[model samples]
Target chain A: MSIPAIASTRNDALASLLDNAINNKTKPLGSLGMLETVAKQIGLIQNTRVIALEKPAILVFAADHGVVAEGVSAYPQDVTWQMVENFLARGAAINVFAQQNGCALHIIDAGVNHDFGPRTGLTDRKLAHGTHNFAQQPAMSSDTCATALAAGMALVAELDGNVVGFGEMGIGNTTAAAALMHKLTGIPVAQCVGAGTGLSADGISHKQRVIEAAVALHASATEPLDVLATFGGLEIAMMVGAMLKAAERRMVLLIDGFIVTSALLVAARLQPAILDYCVFAHCSDESGHKKMLDNLGARPLLQLNLRLGEGTGCALALPLLHAAVNFLNQMATFESAQVSEKSE
Target chain B: MSIPAIASTRNDALASLLDNAINNKTKPLGSLGMLETVAKQIGLIQNTRVIALEKPAILVFAADHGVVAEGVSAYPQDVTWQMVENFLARGAAINVFAQQNGCALHIIDAGVNHDFGPRTGLTDRKLAHGTHNFAQQPAMSSDTCATALAAGMALVAELDGNVVGFGEMGIGNTTAAAALMHKLTGIPVAQCVGAGTGLSADGISHKQRVIEAAVALHASATEPLDVLATFGGLEIAMMVGAMLKAAERRMVLLIDGFIVTSALLVAARLQPAILDYCVFAHCSDESGHKKMLDNLGARPLLQLNLRLGEGTGCALALPLLHAAVNFLNQMATFESAQVSEKSE
Candidate 1:
């Protein structure tokens, strides 16, 4: 099975019209800064000057990584299930922000070790107990990787929104993201690894060693899916699938922090058009986020030194999108408002 | 008349309580980043953990600086009154952002060179037609400066709110802010001046020379008020007054860009306690804004390279405050949520 094609390229034919729509607004040209860019991007994506972010939702995929047994995470692997429960109960930061920003949230259990039988809120799509420890062997088989991706695609296809955001929760996912980054970008593992949740200097060094060992073990994992199967979490694979499907549907995609961005890196590599539907939410304080962002040439909306990965950044940014959309839709043009323009 | 003493000190007594309140939230300690800082600051300012931002308002002071006659600005000085009209008509960027953020904006004719008698939406607080060209003589009389400050104080004193934001409109006020920054902080005029509205490199250099000339002519003006009388716009003086009074009333102040921060620099000098009430809304893309922020030790909430100075930054930041407030008031603690704490 293969990832779905992202067929919607930005409507460059409407570029001139969009510029006039933005510039003719009763303000100095480029005064709105990044907001103008957002308005224009959304307009181009939807192929209409009148852009609406409808039925916005944040899909948080939760799975555990077997590398937690190596003590790579600040929290134990059990916290993955615990955070999912917290999300369902509307107690996490992402939950509060999502509620505040009027975003519907869905928690998907891609491959958590725990078995929550028919939980009301969780979408149970467990691929297995968890991915195998990549430090010792491939994290998932290629078949398992494809299944996880398909789970993500299926989840997004069922969602009722043109604007979607992706976030993830896993105990040792950042370590996996780091290894993936190192392999994909050929950035050093030490540079890619960061103090996720919170790690001491020694622990980070130890993590680097573990990842270096893993990379050496999987030297032939050159293909994106092969690399993902070797080191990526099931949740990451699902997010990769979800992002592709969202783009294929011509929906606006909000990409969250380092872990999610790493997934995007894989997804973008597979189908480069996926990024055209995407807006980076914020630059994470995670050590390698800047490098990943730099490599992608993505300028995020906010940089609050946030390292929380529960789609909190996406929730925080939803209002900016609203503001941008509302301004474009509602603000009177100079001609309409009868405001005098600058004598050029 | 002297600047009113800012009587309210930060509630140090509640610092520990605020910390405990923040730490006890279900999220990890310091995970919220700037949101945690905002919550703590608001909590301390109100002297209560039950902090609420009531009746949020953005006071946009519109004035004209005589230095615009020297070609110190890219736009003609008439743009000040024109933009004020735009604000009233709800056609400007500030108006759009303010409306989007649920901020009740008050446009004050602090000293714009316009005679619009009894405009419905505008607050009539005209000090004079405009300030005197400080390049030729002092900008305003000492008595005028006193009255301007008093007017700012009176505006807030009459208004009913514990949270206020400030924005200003003037074509050459960036010149005034740069001059004030140079004089007050001993930073060079060349370093302080930036493209006001939209100036070419030659235009910026000319602005620098004009400011340097003014500074050389008024070398003896050391006191804050004297400095205001020598070189400040009426809007700047009024903002200085308003900020002091806002702090005195223990209201949370959302300070805007370079012009507002320059006014804040003056207010902070007159009474350093005023700094405690201000949350630098965004770091402006202007040349000297970073220096002003550094001098004040302010870490702004947003940095989208925004240089438009009509309290647009303040309007953008209001939602973050709401998010922070909502999270603190609404999120479940680890104990209440029955989530396990980190084992470290």
Candidate 2:
């Protein structure tokens, strides 16, 4: 899958608008909190009063990994199919959170081994029955990685909605994500490992070793696309494509927990501009995510002890994003409110 | 001014209704994220479907403390009056943030030495010209403490609207707050001390000794009322009143920064049920807040290195709270959406 070409904007225009907002002199210096920063960015990106309303949407791509067979996950590989079924049934956390936040849910079946038919509310973009076992070979083919990215970009273009988020579902995806982060950032997998989805201590060590083994195999692959082919999940590639497209369109990306952040790291390394389009939804209790966030130099919107995936954090964080949009659109300026300024 | 008396509800209806929502069986168990928890809690709290609309309001109580005369704050006491002026002009972070988030704001003159007589956007609840310099003597009369709490209670009783948030605007108020927290939590003022609104190292040491001395004097005082009168600022006393009243009325109390939290500690000791009506908005970068939160077992909603007060953090955080409420109210249940169970 080709990364969607991003639309170029005059950074000069953005800079000027940001300056105007910051210099408006309502409160004392730097008093507006993060919204001050968020507003300026929006003004620069949209280059307008912003029309304020952002459509909330998240794409959760699910795929089975060959590594799941290695017992790295607390849940069985069968649970991936089970959870996908639940997602389609709209019984999952992401589904409920989306409903609550008035966000749309797009479930992409990237490469789950189980066949989920049309009745399950899924979009079939499966590249293979499942990824190749990293213990034996590369996780996916380069072409398959490309195809997944294309699938995600195509969906974003087709949806034509605002503010798309990225998330993933698959037993053992965390192990894959941890491996991917190590590949992209050159961080050690052990440092990136944690008790994913309630894995026990033994489970964590096993998972870490599995990830280390995968990283050891994929160490020399320098190309982002090649790295994805070797170690990326179809779901992660799809997420990268989706994230790129959203950035190109200047839509907000409400990024979820750990595994997704690793995918974002890959996407960012490929296209550094993509970082601006991202909004981290939460600092996952998954310890690795904090490091990932630090390396990315990104601040998340929430810090709840959330470890569940399926784009639930994005759904949960949607309302806050909405408020950010609302405030930027509505608040009266200091001059209009006729409030006094602190003496210069 | 009279302390607003909060009323606790007797409905087992919310509890049963939440229990009903959890067992709906259409979604996977624990898939809905915080929205599900909010929905369940609200169902239990309201005994019906949860409905949240944006009438979010912040009452910022401004006062001057005698401690400022001791040169404890980085900025002089006049900044309080200046910032209050900034708030009314809607240029302050709280003003802009509040405006951005679609929340109404009321600036209350609880005990500021400066005059703010009946501005269009301000509520005058002046208790005293300012408390006596606590470095030399008790900050307030215990009766005045009762008066401030009564005033807070009174305001909420008239709030025939939506959620209520409390923030404070007082130079040198932190010394009073940290002192109160030290006495209340039995942590030394050293752990509780921080650079409030920016204090220099020597200024901080001076601030600490002043608080340590105040705590020593205040430690001998018995009863919550006695503690409030001896050590608390008028704005803090008012906030304590507001929190208790809001809790009694089942109105959400959006708590802000270190000083306000000290008032909350006072209210919580007075009525432990107060915490249920509260949402910790943001953990200020102030070191003491974390310890206070830990002691209270409270989790703040945001933590963006915020140290500015005047309810700015709460204002910035309101949108998130709104998001939480909106998701719970708007998301459809499994039975309503015809979604199947995932355990299938």
Candidate 3:
């Protein structure tokens, strides 16, 4: 299947109007800081001065990673499906945050090893029962990877929202993400590796060695899609597809932490303009996330030192999006309020 | 008038229980970062494992500063009452953010130079028409300063919320804040002074000179209340009182930008224990705010470069407070979710 097209959201005509509207709001020039930038970006994306974030949703894709057999993760592989159950029961951090921020959350079982047959609140889009162990071979066949990508795109097409936040839940996926980051960015494998779900210092060292070896083993897989098939998890690949489709439809893509960003790295490689539609939610406390964000030239909105990523960052940051849009739409102009402008 | 006493929120017995409850919440230990810290702080403040932030509110205090005559700010003094009118009309940045975040907003006319005369949504708490210009003399008499503090405490007492966010609107308040910061923290006047509401390089230099002279004039007033009487705006003095009373009542105090932090510096000095109930909302984009926060050893929840102080930072940050509480109360435990913890 062909990747969806994402147009750059840069309209010089609309940019001037958005800037004028934002500047005239009873605030000192640029006093709202990053929020003003966000407002302008949202306006540009919508091609209008009046922007509204309607029916926001977070899509959390869950799967398992064969790399857990290499002892790269601190948690057992079973936790992936178990957490999917927790999400379905609305007892996870993401569920609580999504509910608090008035976001509709959809949990997708992309390729978990356990069978959670026909569960409510769990969308089944399994590409396979997890990818192959990359320590020994490619994580997934190229055909399976393509199918996962297509599945992700199809899933997003069914959702109704102008904004979509991408999150993931897969035991050992961080190892898969780190490997992808190392191969795609050409950053050192050690720099890409970090403690996944609580690793010891020695465990991180070992995980680094595993990713370095895998990256070296797949040296011929230099293309983004090729590298993704070699190292990316099912959830990560699916997210790449969802992100592309969302941007194709001109929806604001709220990007979460490390693993989710790794998916974005692959998606962005295919469609660099996809960056125009992305809103990085936060820089996670997880090691390498800052570097990953820097590699993408992304400046996230929040830096809360969060690392437990079930889209908690996205949910926490949804209000800032609402605040930005509301300020642009609702705040009185200096002319309207009769507030004095800065002294000449 | 006597300042209200604020007790330390330290409860070692309850701290252990809160920590235990937080650690078991179906995620890696301490992965929630600042949210975990905030949750623990709120739990300790409420003295319960079950925490709820009830009826959150943002109180915006507006007053005119006499220091504006010194040309230390970029806007005219009339903007204070104009912004107050903007707030009453629900057409300000604070109004938009507060409404979006489900925060009840209260606009208190602490002492604007213009007569608002019992506006519908504005509280009548004017200490005077405006403050005496601190560049020439003490901003207010000691008696007036004391009355402002008492009025702030009284105002908070009439409110129903268990949380209060303090914001200010005064053309020359940043000058007042700088003077207070320099005197209290012994930070140099040059370091404390900044571009308030968009001052030029020469305007900031002039501001620095003006504040240096005023600090020298008020050098004899070493006590916190005395310094406040000498350098504080009526709105700032009122905020100092409100913060102290809110802490005394065990309510969470959401502290905003430079002006708000100046009020906090005075309140914290009067009752050092007030720090326990306070949450630094954001480190503003204004120069010296990070230094001021550093002096207080505060790690703010957001760093969006926001400098517009109408409690917009507080309104933006209220959702994080809600997220923290919701995660602590709603997330499933590892045992309950049947998810495996870190492997041995």
Whose DockQ is greatest here? 3
Docking class of 3: high
lDDT of 1 by residue, B1-344 (tens): 56677765556679888888888777666778899889888988888989899999999998999888888877777778878887888877788788877889999999999998999999999999999999999999999999999999999888798889999998789999999998899988888998867788999999999999989898999998899889999999999999988998899999989999999999998999887788888998888999989988999998887888899899998889988898888888878877667765
Comparison by lDDT, 1 against 2, better one: 1
lDDT of each: 0.88, 0.74, 0.92
Candidate 1 clashing pairs, residues 3+ apart or interchain: none
Docking quality (DockQ) of candidate 2: 0.23
> What tens-digit string does per-residue lDDT give for candidate 3 at B109-223?
8999988776799899988989998888999999999999999999999889899999989999999999999989999989998898999999999999999998877779999
Q: All models, DockQ values?
A: 0.60, 0.23, 0.89
Better of 2 and 3 by TM-score: 3
The TM-scores, one per candidate, come to 0.97, 0.81, 0.99
Model 3: CA > 4 A from native: none
Residue B30, candidate 1: alpha-carbon lDDT: 78
Q: What is the C-alpha local distance difference test score of candidate 3?
A: 0.92
**Sequence-dependent TM-score of model 3:** 0.99
Better of 2 and 3 by lDDT: 3
DockQ, ranked from best to worst: 3, 1, 2
**Best of the candidates, lDDT:** 3
- Residues A268-320, candidate 1, lDDT per residue (tens digit)? 89998888888999999889999999988899998888888999999999988
Model 3: which residue pairs collide?
Answer: none
